[model samples]
Target: MPERALRNNSTPAELAVWHRISRFRPAFTRQLVEAPFIIDLACRQAKLAVEFDGSQHLDSVERDARRTAYLQSKGWTVIRLWNSDVLANPDGATLHVLEKAAECLGGTHPQPLPSREGRER
Candidate 1:
């Protein structure tokens, strides 16, 4: 399916996760296209792709593995989250994404500002 259509028809789990991650820095793209496949969500700067999978995905483990391998070959780190888990605990799911992103980016996102404890104000 086209990227736009997949984004427009996002599953509940995807929407929940996006709601939390979309507000952060280094921004994430939903329904991102990487040629042959459409990523559920991706932080391009970090080269990280997050995939939210539903029950149907259980039937296609090999297909998903191939997709992940292809993306990995292209230097993308893929993280998969179950739909049930996201719906049950969106905060935890988003935190995992943030942590992975930070790991991939090699530092904290939005880096902390310099302190000015003694500056005139």
Candidate 2:
């Protein structure tokens, strides 16, 4: 399917994951195109690609492995989550994504400096 169509027709698990991770720093894009593949969700700055797999994936283990290898060659960290897991525990799934993103992004994100306008003269 076309990327745009896939974005518009996201699965429930994809929607749930997106809702949780959309606010993350470095940002994430849904149905992001990466040459031959369209990532379910991707944080480009972190070089992280998140995929939500359903029963259909069980039959394509080899294909998924090849895809992972290809993405890895391009310096991307690919993480796959089961659809059932995302639906059953969105928080846990979100945390997993955050952890992987942090790993790919090299630990915690840099904190911004506090504003000085509130300080007394």
Give all TM-scores, in the order shown.
0.90, 0.89
- In angstroms, the error of model 2 at 50 is 0.5
Q: Kindly report which residue pairs in candidate 2 clash with one another.
A: none
- The sequence of per-residue lDDT tens digits that candidate 1 reaches over residues 1-121 is 7777887899999999899889887889898889888899999999999999999999999999999999999999999999999999999999889889998999875334678889997
Angstrom error of the Cα, residue 117, model 1: value is 7.9
Native-structure RMSD, model 2: 2.5
Worst 10 residues of 2 by lDDT: 105-114
Tens digits of per-residue lDDT, candidate 2, 34-54, equal 889889999898899999999
Clashes of 1: 0
Q: What is the C-alpha lDDT of each candidate?
A: 0.91, 0.88
- Whose lDDT is greatest here? 1
Clash count per candidate? 0, 0
Using TM-score, give the best candidate's number. 1
